[model samples]
Target: MVSKPALRTGGYIFKFFFRETKMNISISKKGISALLASVLLTLAAPVTTLANVKNPGLLVHAADDEATTLDPAQVEPGEGGETIILQVYDRLLDIDPYSPNLVPSLATEVPTIANGGISSNGLTYTFKLRQGVSFHDGTAFTADDVKFSWDRAMEMDLPEGNAGALSDVVASTEVVDDFTFKVTLSEPVADFLNSVVVAMVSSVVSQDAVEANGGVEAGSPNEFMAGNMVGTGPYKFLVWNRNENIQLEVNDNYWGENAKLNVRVEIGGDPDVRVLGLRAGEFDTVETDPSFVADLEGADGVTIYTGGLLLEPLHIGFNLNIPEGSLPDGDTIPEDFFHDPRIRQAFNHAFDYEAFLNGPLAGYGAFNPHYTPIGIFGHDESAPVYAKQNYAEAERLFKEAGVWDEGFSVSVITEEGNLFALMCLVLKDSIEKLNPKFRINVLAVAEAVFDDAHAQNPLEYAMWAKNADPAADPNFYMQAYQHPDGEWGEVHGFANGYKDAGKVAELIDAAAVELDTGKRAALYKELNEILYNDPMWLIGAQEGVVMAHRDWLKGFVQNPLWPRPSLKFALFDK
Candidate 1:
């Protein structure tokens, strides 16, 4: 259903508001949200006419599919990182969500080797840029478009490529003049400015929209950037249809301030058709699910908010090598009888996870033991708890780790929630009460077979599931879940393979080049004691930053990263 013409989207249909108004600073996604109450009554004017006007507010975000492209180097972050980082590309460095540090857009600051910032031999880094920052196809934003968007996803290799994160301490980028540039590093890379504000390595691209859209390739520029978008930030890209809706307007020559609001986006295939188009008003703000959080908990024109959700680690990934690890082309992994760590410590003490977080989240939810999620660094809200019925210490840790081969059993893939189908029926009734020769097999697959069995890394399931949130960086758990051939936390880090000694990938490179906040929190508390004693992964709860608006959707903030339902200091209460 590629759809999108069923206009009057929320119904009672006001028959066209008379189209044609998307020019001098485009408007009308709902007619610039009814001019957002006269730009919040001219918000005390004069920052150059609020930097050219276009804020007031109306944000809508909800994804079930269809944002696979919006040009952050031809988007495909597997699927929606909040519709390509808050309404398509802007990074000249971001991430300040109240103190994770590094701000400034299209750069004026943020780029220095502690001042002199050298590498004449320390490997190199120069930078200067940020002059008259242009490019919504107006060209001019140089240092050779930040050395062609930092080596354009490895000269067009992109699959959201960070050019293999600039292979072994970069070795190129020399512009050094028109606003300077250098970068050379083959060594000293400790947070080389958070590995160069990655949006596909320092996103700035526009070598004439990369040769009008295909000379600096990597795939998915959404057929030449959907509606011709180019960015210096503060909104500009106005239309997309590929799965059902996307709109961003308000670049009013933006250098800053003029960001009141006018960013609409959707991927709605169905979540009851996005809460019936946000309860029939169409949508002014969105981020629904968790079984529509008990149908909007309080209702009456919705508002619901919830924490900031530290980035995403909703968790479950197993492929240590087949019966959980040691794959050979995948699926049907139940052998050597799960090579016994007493059957992965009897399915990790047969997950009761506090009676599945006190049955259906009435208790709301809690239990994460760090595979890294709750605001990063091995979060361990006191680790040990998973006994809905600990089958006598999971049959004494499955006959003391002999992997109780009572005809061997292991198969747990899930995805339809009562919090993961009640932990896949509490690991199939506590791993069949730890013996009946222990047999457990629960399947569930829906939502494109849970996204095509985790993008086809399936080996007949011994373990598989989804959840995420840790990419604000600390090599986001070694470049997405222990870089096991990582391409950005592919449904639970490292679909297992890419140098597996995973000693938290060398303490995620000493907490990503050690900027030293108590030695990067003591090298992330020694990589959370080798990620909770190498459980490889299993963080279950601690994600609350939810949102559901309508009480006139007042001044929003939300962003814990990704289009977390963009509000960026949102407003519209009048």
Candidate 2:
């Protein structure tokens, strides 16, 4: 059975107030909203002072409520888990908020070819750990912990975990001393530091704590560490009330900048409820949808901050290897339907990209055809743009593929949500309109079922999103999508049976080890052209991240690499 924190009456009452008054609050008296009035009363109320004395902290309401796990190595990329993991774990190298370069975190400095810490051949890297640092459990951190953490991550071999980024790169780890270690790579990986070592998956864990809980042999979904945490970060885990909230307290012995406020992360999935909580002073900050910005604009004491385009781009992936008889509605799709480049190209041109972006996306997204965000390296601005709807060209390609005569019916699956489900509907409407014979079925499934379907078969089509780390090279995204035996292709079941899979894998391998930046960029550009012409997936819009916070919440910096803002330096002015 999972252990839960003692339910505080004050916390319960505060949550009740937000849940009850959220939708009904009106602005009538002197143009001051009931929510604003409630805020004023709550600030002045004596009960507020007593409540603060009991629990002096900041409450952050997340738009995403579910967290699969908190164990860094086991965590998939998500808003809730990533937000908490950032607070509980420290990486070897930290992403600088203001720049694209990497900075030191657990390590004293970043290793580079220019620095002697990295060998001349670029196959070996030596890291000097920061001395006097300790985990939240009060155990002193050492190089052994570093080696154990990374080795354990690779040994576990989680297909979905971010640690897969280092699968073939890290040959072995050697602990030199109490505060020093060296990582030997199988090949010269130019972006190994940014892509793998600096990734959150490489976060060091307490070897002793892990052993006591369950070592690598304990298997995945590391239940013990998922609910608990022991790391050398700025905050310590207090309690995780699953699907409800996660409470964290400041680590008094933190080696870096200490967190000013104990945090209470209330898990509310509805954006409107989160907005209401922010207005009623129930939360210090809240992650909100871009659609909610118009409603919250000009509200008192609330500032809407927009984090420009996220690293993730919304796209539609084709299941090239769907079994012939596996589709819904008893329809039998040809085995080679998605594998045919003509069909993929035709599907790409069938969507009305601009209409969907301006309408459902609230005019807050831009077209990116390379399956990569605009700001990242190797984006290939010269690649053929596919932003406009082209039904005539689509018809021609369909005819060439010999699927236009009878037309074909296929079910496209998307997770049940306002954005993704709406995207599926739009595609269905647009594709059906192109030809009456063209049948498109949009299936919106629950999050859990949808995740399983996506991982297992993906049926005929799947609409998904991917976030590539901006600080890392574009090879990270390419390896996942273009390479046949790569993480996403082989593990997550996407583009697994493409004819050029082997060739794409070879190109990706070549690009990974290329030391010259220009040569690497050219190789990626060539790969982008191949994928663009063949069209593995239909690239969609780059969505923006919009958030709202109270004016008193300070020092919140948005990093593209993370789904949520970095709260390490954040403080509650109140």
C-alpha lDDT values of all predictions: 0.54, 0.70
Tens digits of per-residue lDDT, candidate 2, 1-574, equal: 1111121221111111111222222222343355556656644554333334222455454444656778878876554676788788888888787656789989999987787789999899999899999998888999999999988888776766767666678888999999989999989997888678767678889998999887775246567987899998888999987656788888889998777787877775655556666665667777665556655666666778775666666777776666546667734456556767788888889887876676655567777756556766777788776788899999999999898889877777877655666566667777888889888777777767776776664344433432333335687778776677765576434454455767777888898899888998888877877777777777667777667776656676666664354444333434
lDDT tens digits, residues 9-55, model 1?
11111111111221222233464454443333333333322233222
* Superposition error at 81 for model 2 (Å): 2.3
Clashes of 2: 0
Which segments of candidate 2 are over 4 A away from where they belong? Answer: 1-59, 158-160, 212-222, 330-333, 457-471, 488-502, 563-574
Query: In model 2, which range of ten residues has the least summed lDDT?
Result: 10-19
- TM-score of candidate 2 to 2 decimals: 0.85
